[model samples]
Target: MVENRRRSEEPLHCLVTGASGYIGGRLVPELLAAGHRVRCMARSPGKLRDHPWAGDVDTVRGDVQDAESVAAALRGIDVAYYLVHSGSGAGFEAADRRAAEIFAAQADACGVQRIVYLGGLTPRGIPESSISPHLRSRAEVGHVFLDGPVPATVLRAAVVIGSGSASFEMLRYLTERLPVMVTPSWVHTRTQPIGVRDVLRYLVGSATMTDEVDRAFDIGGPEVLTYREMMCRYAAVAGLPRRLIVPVPVLTPRLSSHWVGLVTPVPAALARPLTESLRYEVVCSEHDIATYVPDLPGRPLPFDEALSLALRRVREAQVATRWSSASAPGAPSDPLPTDPDWAGGSLYQDERLSPVDASGEALWRVVEGIGGENGWYSFPLAWAVRGWLDRFVGGVGLRRGRRDTERLRVGDSLDFWRVEEIEPGRLLRLRAEMRLPGLAWLEMWVETDPQGGTRYRQRALFHPRGLLGHVYWWLVLPFHALVFGGMTRNITLAAVKGAPARVNEARAVRIRGDRRTRRTSQR
Candidate 1:
């Protein structure tokens, strides 16, 4: 077709197939502030190198049912974004219909110029009966991503409020810790939810609508709520008060996604594919996305100002992630969670005083090359803005950092601490992955007590797992007593205040809420 109408009149080269998704991480910064030329597609492009749209993207790791990484992320791609999904694999609808039948037969032999997809909204004729199986495999992966590419728009959204959405962080943790709820009957099922800035303004207004090929709109947010009136409009935008919801029709969606995986941290295979795709209904009917966003003004902000801007973006914890595929990136979690809010117990000690010209094997080769992707020596952009504000209020920040940067294991993941014990010249321990209402630790030790020389000890321990973990460690004990007493007086004034402070393999990090990152050895 004239090379698909000369590649849809050039100027798009996009290819965002679930580029580390959550609506392709907010549609790659609205398709790069609308200049287009994305190409993200991931199986982990170096864990999306610090995404904020990570340098306006063009990455490409693989797997869209890997046909050579979706034919090299659809070579010369002009447009192809069918967002991958695999809510806990092993035949996730035959892996989302064999990855949309192998990226729609390699985006139809790579002449691709269009295919945008982003399904969810389900109400049309209102006969969604018993619809589960993850919303009928998300409506059969939107009919195999509009069967074969090049001319497919499909928006169809629903609960995408944002801030690391797991249906808006399980309604901001059952409205900030069960203020008083007992929800069921899919909480009253209705839903129209939309937000993430109106699903990136209807996927960048369906990438400049060109006679909406093979279309399928149905967006949302004009309000039609119900998940217990959107969790009392997110407890009146988290100021709380009004949660008295006691429906309880035999709590099930596998026991409310395991009581929403114990008061929220949404994991139960991503909260059972977000509670089995909300039984049904997701408003949005004609008015054709306001006749194509007629200046996308108002009328999409009720339900308590979109749950108070999605709980002020999860209490202003500035997240930039919502990773799923059940936390892939070498997935393997389940050896610790005993749900007393994820069991805790820790201790650490680190003491130092050597720089008569510094060298305990060069400070144990900079604390055994610290974490993965080389980082964590000292204040890395305040530890990546406090691990993107603890992943924007849902926790587990700086994403478990150590996957390998100079071998030193015991259940790795070393950013939000997880080494849990190591000794190269004297102990090192860590365990908190941020989420403490109880146990936590970051121990470090290196001795020489008889006064032969060194003596470093650094500790930040906590074991509060009950009275709301001792009222959240005495309400963050004076900011964890001034960030662990000013980070052990700035690592002993940078070991005599100078030379030996350079190893940011890439800006070291591990800090958030009384900040952190520990592991010290010298001799």
Candidate 2:
């Protein structure tokens, strides 16, 4: 057994998988701050480049399913954090089991000192079969690690309350959007929610656990509250009118998830598992983690305090990572086809060019702040209708919004589209995530015309999958003038009409608001 004192005295080398994901992305910096050398492994390493701590840690392109890559990533690592999970879906359990086995095998082969994993908190007396598939799979993964040759520390948590997290987003939208909600019976179920800060702290501290202490630990916030209580508290924290929640037993997990999909940014696919997990009570059974990583003052923040912190981050747009940080599975990764005569089937494009009476900087500002509360500058009804239709069909609606109102990174999600690429003041390209027959992309460019004026260029590209895809594109072709055309004309007009001043004013207000918040917290 490794001595805890010896392990704590030396800085350990850590390997963090799923570095592009929500928890993993935030964990890298925390580990680095604790004097550990970190290496990050992701399927797309480029996705992690935009993070502020990207340069501080080494990154490698690797997937857990690939044994060779996993082995290579685990090489020379004292501790490995298994943060990757096949989010709820078909065959996710088998995939998760296989991935865990491969990870454990590699970690053992590499002589890793400890394996740290974050998993869902299961109800104490509930049978395994009664648990949701998401939680069941997580438990199986934890078992794989604990029963392996290497020592493991599995931290089980209920819903994580943080700005931009899926669970918190669901809670925020439901409570804020619907003043009166007919909620599922699960809303009455009790849960011990944890803050993201505490989760990260426990994850980092788990690295030096004694070898004999290979087991799962229940970690959660200081208070245990029902889902209904959480929603009420969330509304209070957000300074909104108290929500009236009516619990109805008729709404099963499936029906509730679909309802949540329609109302929140989280789509049905992701919401289903979350809603299902809420069916069981998940209060923490013990606080054994404090025995090893002693809690400091105000440690494991109170539920209301966590909610306040999350709300503050959302209001200030200081969110470090979002649930949308990870790319949706099967999202198109192909670069925009530049060749007109390419052999990869038909490519359709609607191009719009307009001369702006404003500087290029002004035009770029309007483009960057196009979505979220600043509604897309176009036929408002058309965009809203389209977003609703997408949501109805189990797609990510425009409600997902943008991570930051005034800025965008490469992997940021903008409405139903993901930022594929962005060049500071020149270009911004978005790839569609809404369900469609084929692939689609929207590109906006700010350039200087030959006449020394600002040129705003917009293009909508579609790559059809089959005959249906081609037909689908043509069917929507007639509305291009009103949809795409209006976007172009209105965007340019907004840019010319005091866009620079508006942007600066908004920035100033945000800065002032942040200062006030800091002073209040201090007082």
Candidate 3:
């Protein structure tokens, strides 16, 4: 390929699947920064439209399981990054195997030069059957690529220490939420965790490797620490007093996953696989990747440094992509909010319309700034109770706050909801991520009334699935007045109070501009 020249020497056309996912979202910018042309393949390309680098790359709607789509995405691509994985769930292994096989076959048919995969690192001596289904599925996917006609490089990593990563979030929540933790036996298991930066470096470098390298490489940081030691070190790094972690033998992976789900923002479906994989030592067996990628000075950051970096990102809210960036498998497939109510069966709506005293822009500002630190303008205790209930049922709790403080994006996660759609200052629609029997959406709109005043329209819609869905909807119907009604009243009041400041700021800017113009005219 390209007469043995370094891939860096010539810009390679790269196709990144799962562009909306955590790793794939971060990897695309890195590849582009290195002068590689990137084409992203996503099932919903709109999810990526809000990304800063979205305009620089080409995005196509495609699913890995669809052979025709995969083949089309792979065409005219030098290297294809397989970042899409069926996350740990029931029947995930089969789904992973099928997707990998399809992707490998499509890559081969498309004449792709290289295929790079990021997979979990399995224990050194353990058999595939002994490992967790998540890790085994990952290994199987890697093997499928390596065994394919196209040359493939599989980078196996242990726990990735990064802000917005599932592993780091689990550790962060567990350590921060509880000063004393009754943990599972897996806390003593050893793991060599790697930083997200190093993982991306290795991934980008793999694209340029000689065609001869097609096997799997274990990638991790220099230090290896037990889960207990990591938590202790994390507490220390976070400036918290040492944690009390009691390892109990009675807690199985399933129980521990539930416990983690209750305590952390990560749902049980994801936490289960993570806790299961921690049962064995996942230290890197070899550092053979350095021979090709070659680590730079202070390249693979130490455990504490990685922890510090991740913490800093979390504190600053600079995390680029979160684990929630990718929707869970089998997410609700109901009709969108734009669709007519009749299209979706048995649609229930709790609609509230309030006339606001403030400008539409002011109302919009309050709407966009809702959630996160600014608690939902309704009943705080009710929202907290609802969040706790969701966590108890293995749903993404309200702890998964908004990415930015005052900005609303198409795919941003706000509390227990995901931003399904946003029309600038006009409309903000959020889909429920909490565990519910039916699909739910909350739509907030800033509109101008006939009298030329700001009008705030709020609607909570639910499309019932079955009998249980209808029961669930009626069960929560009584609280709608306090929850939805209070929101309408408080939001408008906040906008009214905030509108004067906005007007003053605009006036001040105009005054300064006028003075500057006067001085320019005199000169």
Candidate 4:
């Protein structure tokens, strides 16, 4: 019976509603890896970055609010992952509540088999059950979905422990920045934290195993530790000794949310939901989920183990952006070096300027000619090879050509470089498409003053990921200089040659026209 059920739902064609979110962003890739064809539904289809397999999956731009769009997005989608929440939207609770109902109904109408959601996990059966508005809303959203549409397989989980996640980022920044911590009553609350990997496994694994479960279930990591303990464990994995953790009863969730905004990268809007949920004890009530998701059956992730792995992945992603050619094509061939001396990823930026006598117009032409037919103005072969490798990292290889022969505009994608900023004869700055350990930018400018016809300059900017990220900058200084200098010189020479020819042609045309007019007058 299990085999038949598994085969019937084999390679589930899944549709994720919040494919652009952090969880959904990771979930799309996970679902695909599990032999499922995924339709990534998000508010902005363009927001979907260039993943190597980006073309394989379907992408639909639709909001949960618009019934028509939602119905269309859910059409033919088997397992629709309800990853959306009211946090960032206009109608926080009402909008989310309504949207889920509409989507659940739409999913039912569309024949979707399951609606997988990751929401807040609060102990519901307790005698004096008191939960915050945020937790209550989350629970309501799940219940509304499960009751209406397809069998809703709700995976109620605590704050996911990973980088780039709001909850995780709040925790990460609080511990990293504050060597001496202050007090929050919620710090003493016992909670079960789960690793992102386990959460993903349970969500994907739930699709195949649906025999006994008809409703929502709690999903958490292996340990039930206090908020303070979770913080200390995170510190240990970060290789830092735990600082003093003091729990104060006076600090309210409102006050704590603001404090988080000041201390963590998490903004106030994001912090409030997490901070509100922190008031209640977020632990699993039953262990009956053993037979379903075997990966997490025996044990949940140790706080330290989850922290180490999640941090490593974030570091890797940051660094991956650096070395990956998609970060910047035709960029100086010099990549940030691996200082085994550092951990995770290397992120660093090097900036230098060399004089190249090129006209603004000529330089503009060269910049326009970048990518596609002309190849990158600097390190053409290296750029091509790098782009080819980026294809391995799941990026768009040098396929998209320029829109026009000589014009540029914003929002236009040029090969790997999205048109970030453009000035006709002066500046062209491109954000890196290739992966990097951190954020990076490449810029070329032709500055023309009254005294100077044009001055060509190039800059490479990198934002480091961590300690190693800083080290990456110092190591690649010389090579960046070399590659950047060569590119600048080439652009200068190309522009210089191009300008005079046009000038001479104009002069010659004027002389010929003058002679013709003089002869006509004599006649």
> How do all models score by TM-score?
0.36, 0.66, 0.67, 0.64
Best by TM-score: 3
Residue lDDT tens for model 2, 238-338: 66677788999999889999999887657688889999888889989899999989998998899888877765533332211221222321101111111
Q: Output the lDDT of residue 153, model 3.
A: 97
Order the candidates by lDDT, highest first — what do you get? 3, 2, 4, 1
* Candidate no. 1 TM-score: 0.36
Worst 10-residue stretch by lDDT in candidate 1?
Answer: 330-339
What is the C-alpha local distance difference test score of each model?
Answer: 0.62, 0.82, 0.82, 0.69
Q: Candidate 3 lDDT, tens digit per residue, 464-506?
A: 5434666888999999999999999998898989943464467
Q: Can you write out model 4's per-residue Cα lDDT over 227-312, one digit (the tens) per residue?
A: 88877877777666566877778988889999887775566877887898888887898655556777534456677877876666
Candidate 1, residues 1-523, lDDT tens digits: the string is 5232323344576888765555675577677777777878778687667555577677978887778778887988867778777866567877887887778778878877577778777766745445666666777777776765557777777786645556776776666567667777888888788676767766766765563367677777777878887777666665555667788888877888888888766678878767867756667776476665553557655556655564442233221112111111110111111112321111112223332223344444445555555555455676677688878889878876676555677767787767656778766666677655544656555556564655556665554432355466666666543555555445444444332345343233422322332232221
| Number of clashing pairs per prediction, in order | 23, 0, 0, 16
Pick the winner on TM-score between candidates 1 and 4.
Answer: 4
Candidate 1, position 391, lDDT: 81
What's model 3's lDDT at 494?
A: 86
Candidates 1 and 2: which is better by lDDT? 2
